[model samples]
Target chain A: MTQDETMISVRNIGKRFGSVVAVEDACFDIRRGEFFSLLGASGSGKTTVLRIMAGFEAATSGAIFIDGRQMDAVPPHQRPVNMVFQNYAIFPHLNVADNIGFGLRKLKLDPVERRRRIDEMLELIKLPGFGDRLADQLSGGQRQRVALARALVLQPKVLLLDEPLGALDKQLREQMQVELRALQRSIGVTFVLVTHDQEEALTLSDRIAVMADGRVLQVDTPAGLYERPCSRQVAGFVGNMNFLPARVVSQDGGSARIDVPGLQTTCSISAERLARFGSDISLAIRPERMTLHRERPADQANSVSGVLHDRMYLGERTQFQVALDDRGTTIAVSSSTTVAERLGSIDPGAQVWLSWSEEALIPLGND
Target chain B: MTVTSELNAPAGADKTAFAGLRRLFFQNESLRGLVLLTPTLVILSITVIVPFLLMGAMSLWTQIGFDYTDDWSFRNYGIILTEPLYTTLLLRSLGMSMAATLVTVMLAYPMAYFLAFHVQKNKLIWLIIITLPFWTSYLLRVFAWRVVLGYEGVINTGLMEIGLISEPLSFLLYSKSAVIITLAHAWAAFALLPIYVSLEKIDKSVLEASADLGEGPVMRFLRVILPLSMPGVIAGTFLMFIPTVGDYVTAALVGGPDSRMIGNLIELQFGTVDNWPMGAALAITMIISITMVGLLFMVLSRLLKRWVAA
Candidate 1:
């Protein structure tokens, strides 16, 4: 991206707490008006990266540029960035108006302008006339909005949010995820959110940089990352998957022929998707892609012989665990409507067939 | 119908009673908290409240020599208020204590701040060091201060050694300045601990958040640190000021007639004059004055809080 379009450029940024490296060699460019997310599990340095970008943490060695200005040595307050902390960090001593206008107060804005901005922020957050209430008086969702208003009122070039909705319950969390995305879009400022929740990241981010062990694993759109994971770890982290140990029997075009112990099957999987070449390579398949059959299908390349172990009846679908002959468990999800017909009222020990499309069997990295 | 169905059941009745009790406990958390703190309440009433009540009652009575009677009057209060000498002594004590508390706070604040936010390790060591002077005998410490501030004391000797002054400064000893210094030293621990506790209770993350909001170190200190530590500042001031007003030892050991505090005058009326009534009256006057000052400080603290909130 060009310098003008790129709101933040993190170059070789690293952070170390004594001998332990919290984040290492992290680099990324965030464009203006993009809703970007740093997705990772706990202790994966996503929060550390956001803090470094926000100038709350000093880089052990590296530099950050916000709007073409070096920010490695700049303190957090002087930077043109505001953060919505996981805990909200609303000034407990101040009411809603004061909390929202805290940064504005530092600007020496006229009282009328400050009040006007605070009122505008409150309305934008859908919390009109909440100025007189204490932060503790608000509910969880209200507090989250107040936090967002507090950051947005500053009109920062970049807004860093660290687990912004992690404190809410599941229902509210899901609702706020969409609300936050719309808010970010409406405000037209680059938003950098850090969260460990995969669904939250996928739902909110226009682009996501997946992190693991203080390193960026992949940077892609949410759909791209989900549909095309670069590694077995990323695939497992992003969604559930079933793996079958296989060896590459032959290679043709961009696809590979693989063999498994239980069946001499020639499954078509992409060669470029493989992380390593050896006698052992796992063919990763998602559970939703697998189909269960009562009787063996006439002709299927990627098919397995198994016995139906048990069935978990979810509201929308049913997940069946099939015990394969190779001592591996393969799970298959069928819609509740077709589950009974496909399985034919199967018991725990009924013999079954698990089959999937050729494109469903994606080769994964050795992890 | 369901309630009627379960009404005859013994299990349901027992469960309902237990649930009600649990709900009651949950609802009156303040009462439960007081119940949990019964030991503290009992100890405070025995050591503090009982003596205070007795003192208040004693202040209203007249005593004839060593005789005790049911007779009560405001004669002692009248004597204390009418006497300009006692009133002057009381005012002098208030001034001295106020100065000492202010000086102690000024010295303790930066030290407390450093210990709270700056120091990464061995914090307990620094705390002990700040409290080291108090570990020794209070009388010994006062006497030591007297010696140090004497005509041929360490300050004069050190100045002579440095060739800054040829002779000792006689005006420095046996005066209000000496009393102020001695009282400050005596109460330094009181001032430091409350301030330190307040500083320690401050959420470090709040300060970090303030800094992250674009405030410089000085502005953050003014806007966050000082305001947040106000409770401790008030606590430390009251902790030092209230007791210092009644202090007589430092005055006797180091102060002259002009520097004599309320405690010294009260002791004089009872000991030399053998007039318990006047002494009790003086004691009542001091208590009332100190009580008013303490109440005023509390109000001031509340007002400051509102201002900070604004």
Candidate 2:
């Protein structure tokens, strides 16, 4: 991305709360009009980074730059960003219209223009007739929409959302996720969301920064983070992966033949496919990448023999726990229910075969 | 549990009737509740209701030379309506209480706000400290104020010692301001508690939301904090003002002849003046007037709260 495409440049920001480190050396650039997300578990310091960007919390070191202007001296109210708090924080005393019009107060727009703006926002949030409804009268999903409309009515350059849909039911959360993406697209404003839910981050973001233990582990697109994560932390967080101990057998200029004793296979992996780290290297494979078969597949290079310990029939997929013959190490294998049905039923203690392509093996880094 | 048992008390119903009544007592929930409340009701009827009824009856009767007159009349109320002394003292008492209520609420608001927002530790200890003054007797508190505001009291003596005045300040005591100041001080805890409770009930995130919406600290307080804390403000005003309006002890101790209130006049009629009917009438009149003023205040405050929110 060019300089103009960069909307927010966070440079080495850190926050310490008196002997407790909250965020340390966080650095990332959010592109203009892009829906970016900071994905982490609780206590990963994602919220702290978003707060710093919104000017709610000042970083103990480094600074934040929005639209190429340093925001160190700016207060939250004066900053060009607005936040939708975790609890929505709808002013209880005010009705929906007044809540949305709150930030418009400082603008001092005429009455007609102000009403026009508020009505426009209400329409955009699909709450056109909810102007007279008080905060407490709103349902959870409606309150989430109203919060979005309130922040958007200010015409901020960036919108910060902190677990905006965490309070909604599962069904409502999925609906709001779709609507949130649509809203962000229509407005074409930079959106920086903080959430611990990896699925939400993947579905809503153009790029995600995975954080752990107050540190940003990696920043990548959803597909990139899942397929080519630079570290073990990002791989495990984004999706489920089984780690297999591997050793280097030989190395060429562009490929390395590694011995994965757990899979009972030796495969040649391209250099770009490995994130080699730690004293002993380990390779990761997604459960869905491995195919399970009753009979030995002929001429398959990456094949292993294991015993079927158990199987779980999920609605969309079937999960099998296979213990490899090498050391009785259990590795989870998942396949579509259709594929598992085609192979017939397999009982516990029955022999089975698991196979995968060389491209499925991803080497993880220790850090 | 059987409804038919009520219709059949039995032929030899002596013991059977008693047994049936006991079963009814155990079965009827509301009956048990009424029986449980009888003792409190009996005590209240004797101590509060019976005296109020007697006072109401006496307020309509004319007293003749200490002998009881059963004939009911409005002669005492007519006197109150015609006498300038009654209305003057009544209005003076109201004005003083209003002044006192205003001062108390204004002073207590900051203390309550500080307790709610700034003090992060030992909150209960601070609460106990503010209420520590109430551990002293009410009369002792009034006398302490007299010492602080008397002719040669703390303020006057300290000023004289500093050579700021040629003579002691007489206005410091035996004046309406003296009564107002003492009343404000004496009832401060009543004002502080309600204000503190209301302020504490406010969600801190609402204040942050206000700041995020581009309001500075002062505007946030005015727009958010003050309006949200109005319940406590209204409660504090009522607690301080209503009781002080009928307070005789404070006025008698610090107020001089000109600063005498309606409470003092009513006490005089019942005591040295030996006019029981007149005293009863004055008490009834004060109660009615305060009730009306309090209702008006409540309506106005509700309107103000809604207006500010709007």
Candidate 3:
């Protein structure tokens, strides 16, 4: 992103809780009008990073800048950022309008202006005529919207959301993901979301920062992170992945000779896919990229023969767990349409060959 | 929604009262609940409600041989209220109780808030220490204060030995201030526990939300913490005020003649003066006054809630 369009820049941020490091050397930039997400599991330091950016937590050793101004010493209340907490945290004593207008009340906005903005926000969140309703009277989705309206009504330079859809049901969560993104786009303010669901990050964010064990593994666009993972951890985290350990035998012209176990012939992977020679190498492929067939196909470059160990029939797709002769397990997910047309039917202990293009299999670094 | 509403409707308004009675006896969980609570209710009625009703009746009659069956009259109430000394003592007791409750709450709120929010893992230890005095006898606790504030006590002796005073202070143990100080120390835990429970039950995320929305610490406490804990404050004040008004030990032990509370006066009327009717009337008056003040607090809290919301 351009520096002029950068709204919040986190530089070398880290946090420690007693002897446990929560976030380590975390750095990312949020564009002025883009929705960015930090995706990780529990205890992966995603929330700690967001809290440091929001100034609720001070970084152990780094700086946070908003609009190019240093904010290391700024307290959370003084920072030009507002957060939509995971629990919605709507002030229970206040009605919906007062909750939405709470921050403006602190700014000493005119009473008439405050009322107008509160009404506008309630309508924006599609809760018109709900100003007098107590927060507990609202449904889960309504409370989430009220929280969103409250955070956005401040018109802060950056809007931080911590698992903003966590309280809603699955359908409501999906719906709010779209609505929240659309609202962010229309408001033209930078949005930073933190979630553990990679699909949520992919669906709602312009860029995703995948975190694990208090360290950021990679930060890229969702497609880039999924397609071009830099490490084994990222590949396994972002989607269903299959890894086959291999040894680099030779290299020439964007293709490399590799000895993949469970097959007699040495395979040729793209030389561009290689990280370094003599490293304990592994080939990574997404489950959806590999195809299954009952009989071997003619002239397919990378083909593996294995017995199907298990099969799962999801509503829209069929997943196969295949066991190789001398190697570990590999899984493949195929749509039901292919199950009807190509393979006809599937069962355990059936012989199958899994084939994929050389470029589809990404070679990941040991690090 | 229709199914749930139908299922939730109270059992058959169309049914006969006898059928309703049968349903209550045979089918209702609430009846079972009441059955389980019957013994406690019986005990409370015999120990508390029956005596309270008897006192209410006695307040309206002339006392004959410690009984109210002789004559029904409001003469005792009329005499008690008309007496300037009695009314002054009643008012003084009310004022002192109010002042003591105020001082106790003001001191307890910060300590409770600190324990609830800032003490973290060691909070239960601090709470136990705050409540440690209550495990001992109330009379012993009052006597302990005598040692702290007596003329030749630790405070006076230390000050005099340090050459800070030529004489031990006589004003420390027998004045109205002494009564208030003694009561405050004695009832400090009573006021702190309810407030602490209230503070502890509040969602810390709400405070975090306040700060996230740009509210300062003072503003957050005023707007969120204080109002949310009003129920506890109301409960603590009621807990302190009701018993303190009728407590004779603190007054008799720590107060001078002029500082004697309504409890001391009532005890004198019943024990020394042989005026049972007037003492009953005074007890009735004290109960009514406390009930009125408690109601006023409830109303004030409700009004404050509305005012803050508005």
**Best candidate, lDDT:** 2
Provide per-model DockQ scores.
0.47, 0.52, 0.51
Off by over 4 Å in 1: A252-255, A260-263, A269-280, A329-344, B1-79
User: Candidate 3 chain A: worst 10 consecutive residues by lDDT?
Assistant: A332-341
Worst 10 residues of 3 chain B by lDDT: B8-17
Candidate 2 lDDT over A40-82, as tens digits, reads: 9999999999988877789999989999999999987788888
* Candidate 2: Cα lDDT at B175: 92
Q: Model 2: runs farther than 4 Å from truth?
A: A272-279, B1-46, B68-70
**Fnat scores for every prediction:** 0.57, 0.48, 0.68
- For DockQ, candidate 1 versus 2, the one ahead is 2
Interface RMSD of each: 1.8, 1.6, 1.5
lDDT of 1 by residue, A1-367 (tens): 7788888898988899999888889888888899999999999999999988887788999898999999988878889998888888877777899888877767888889889999999989999989999978999999989988888888888989999899999999888988888888887899999999998888898899999999888889998888778787888888777766778888888977777664447776677765365647777777888888888887666677798888877767777888887756556545464565555677889998877787776776566
The candidate 1 chain A region of ten consecutive residues with least summed lDDT is A329-338
> In model 3, what lDDT does residue A76 have?
88
The TM-score of predicted model 1 comes to 0.89
